[model samples]
Target: MRGIRNMVLEILETAFIQRALVTGIAVAVICSAVGFFLVLRRHSLFGDALSHMAFGGIAVGLFTNIYPLWTAIVVSVLAALGMTKLRQSTKVPPDATVAVLLSSGLALGIVLVSISGGFSVDLFSFLFGSILLVSPDEVYIIIGLSAGIMAILLLLYRKFMYIAFDEEQAKVSGLQVSKLNYLFIVLASITVIASIRLVGILLISSLIVIPNITAMLFGKGFRKTAIISGAIAVSSVIAGILISYAANIATGGTIVLVLVMIFLAALVAKKAERTKRLAGIKAEA
Candidate 1:
């Protein structure tokens, strides 16, 4: 415990740690807000697909000697749009489309890496992430993406919530559910691309989905869910960073591990509370 405390203080004494903490918190909050709708809609796999696709984009950028992030963002957005288009045009389920996109994108990334002679570092970065290397420019980009995500989520809060709770009713209410759905995908695309810098492509979806799952254990209403989820996500990020610093592990993986622990803890606590409530009722009766 003393060593952990000392390490925490040492990390705080460094500028890089401060920046990482801020960046992780920012991305965590962004992911959690989007995640609330994501989990309920069963789009977790879809989000995972986009994260893997972003790997292909990064690989292409590295092979072509261009900024990998541009490719990452463009590929993610276009793929998401394609998913949206296919969903509208065919009876094929969304999961099937995601499967196709995911396999092809992952294959492309592998092929690109193998042909480039050696891209293990790049591949690993996409897979596990390298949050410590986050630069000032990337930090700005993350902040910008965070702002854009928040604005879109806030502006369309009602429509998204409607679709989240009752898609059929939302469709009948003339909510332009299809359009809103596409818009949501676009936002998620941006989010995935941005967060990959902090969380990596492979583990990024966990960052998105876990906090929302944690909140579903305790949150009573939609708004409360978002709030609680965001809080959990932020706490997980903070804990992840501190653990990473103390353990000399990858920040993304550490953060993800922390999130899982949090989810477990929340579930156990909620179950205990419910059990106690039930016992109290029995006693009163």
Candidate 2:
């Protein structure tokens, strides 16, 4: 306890830690918000696909000497929009499309990496996340994007929730389902890219989906679930960042592991509640 407290104090005194904490929490909140809808809509793989696609985007940016993060944002958003169009306009299954995009993105990244003369430490940091290395400018970018995403989402909350629960019904009910779908993919893409600095390309989806799932174990409605999921995701990121600092582990992976552990705990608690309820019912009978 004393050591943890000391570490916390130490982190509070460091600008890097402060930046990482803020950036991580922002990313968590944004991802959690979009993630809840993504999970409900069964588009969980969308984040994973976009993350890999962003890898290719990053590689291209680095090879061309442009700002990699911005490049990634553009490329990912385009890919996401393209995927949505393909899904709406083609007979290819959504999973198949995602799989194709995922492979192509990874292959393109590898080729770009080779063309760029192999991977560098910075590239590795982007791939696996390096929150502690985030610059002040990057922090500003992250926070700005997070706020914008959250705002747009809040404004369209009803339409998004309606679509998430039932797209066919939403379409029938006069909601612009296609437009909303495109909007959602764009939002998801932005969230995934924004999160790359904190949790990296590989683990961003876990950050998106796990908290929502964990919250769903107990939350009875969409609003409650989203609130709980956001809280869980933020808590996990904050805890993971602090523990990683103290334990000298990789922050991205540590945050993911922490989320998994919380999910497991939630699973156990849910099972216990179900059993107790069942026992009560039997006793009453």
Candidate 3:
């Protein structure tokens, strides 16, 4: 315990560590909040698809000598919007669209990288993440975007809830279901892009997904599930960062593993609760 505390204090004294912590917490919060709706709407793979699209975007930016993050945001948002439109207009299943996009994005990224003369260190960072390399400017952008997303969520909570529960009903009730669906895809795209720097392209979806799954094990309502998921995500990031720093492992991988452990723990608790309830019912009978 003493060693852990000392290590944490030592790590905290570094600016890089501070920036990583702030950016990670911000990313975790937004992802958790948005993930609630994503999971409920059965669009969890949407995040995975968009993340790969961000990879292609980054390659485009790199090939053109532009800032990759902005390029990724643009590409991802457009692709997300396109995916939504395709799902609405075509006879294709949403999952099929996502799968097609996922593979296409990865293939595009690889081809672009080849054209750009193969993988560079910068490209590798986006693939696996380098939290220790998070810049102050990126930190600010992450915080700003996260705050904006939270505000939008708060403003449209009821509408979003209705849409998540029943899109057909929401549309019948005069809610702009189509517009809201587009809005959510845009939000998810932004969240995925913002997370890429911290958790990387491959694992960013895990940040958006695992915490929400863990919270759902408790069988809570949507709002409570979101709140709990956000808390769990933030805590896991903090814990994972510290542990990774102390043990010298990959931060993103560590954070994802921590989330998985939390999910397993939740599963055990939920099962125990069910057993207890069933026993109580039997005793009462």
Instruction: Report clash pairs, candidate 1.
Output: none
- Cα lDDT tens digits, model 3, 1-285, are 998788779999989999999999999999998898989888888889999999999999999999998999999998889988999999999899999879878988999999878999999999988888898888899999999998898899899989998989999999998998899888889999989888899998899989998998888887788899999999999998888888899998999999999999888888999999999999999
User: Which ranges in model 2 have alpha carbons more than 4 Å from their true place?
Assistant: 1-3
Candidate 2 clashing pairs, residues 3+ apart or interchain:
none
Question: Which ranking of candidates, highest TM-score first?
Answer: 2, 3, 1
Q: Name the 10 consecutive residues with the lowest summed lDDT in model 2.
A: 3-12
| TM-scores of the models, in the order given | 0.94, 0.97, 0.96
lDDT of 3: 0.91
Backbone clashes in model 3, listed as residue pairs: none
Q: Number of clashes in every candidate structure?
A: 0, 0, 0
Compute the lDDT of residue 111 as modeled in candidate 2: 99
lDDT-wise, the better of 1 and 3 is 3
Error of 2 at 72 (Å): 0.7
lDDT of each: 0.86, 0.92, 0.91
lDDT of each residue in 1-285, candidate 1, tens digit only: 998788679889887777787788889888988877889888888778988889888899999888888998889889889988998899999889999889877988889988998666766876787777888888888888899899989999888988988999999998898889889998998888888867788898898898888888886887888898898889888888877877888888898888899889888999999999999999999
Estimate candidate 3's RMSD in Å. Answer: 1.3
**Residue by residue across 128-174, what tens digits does model 2's lDDT show?**
99999999999999999999999999999999989988889999999
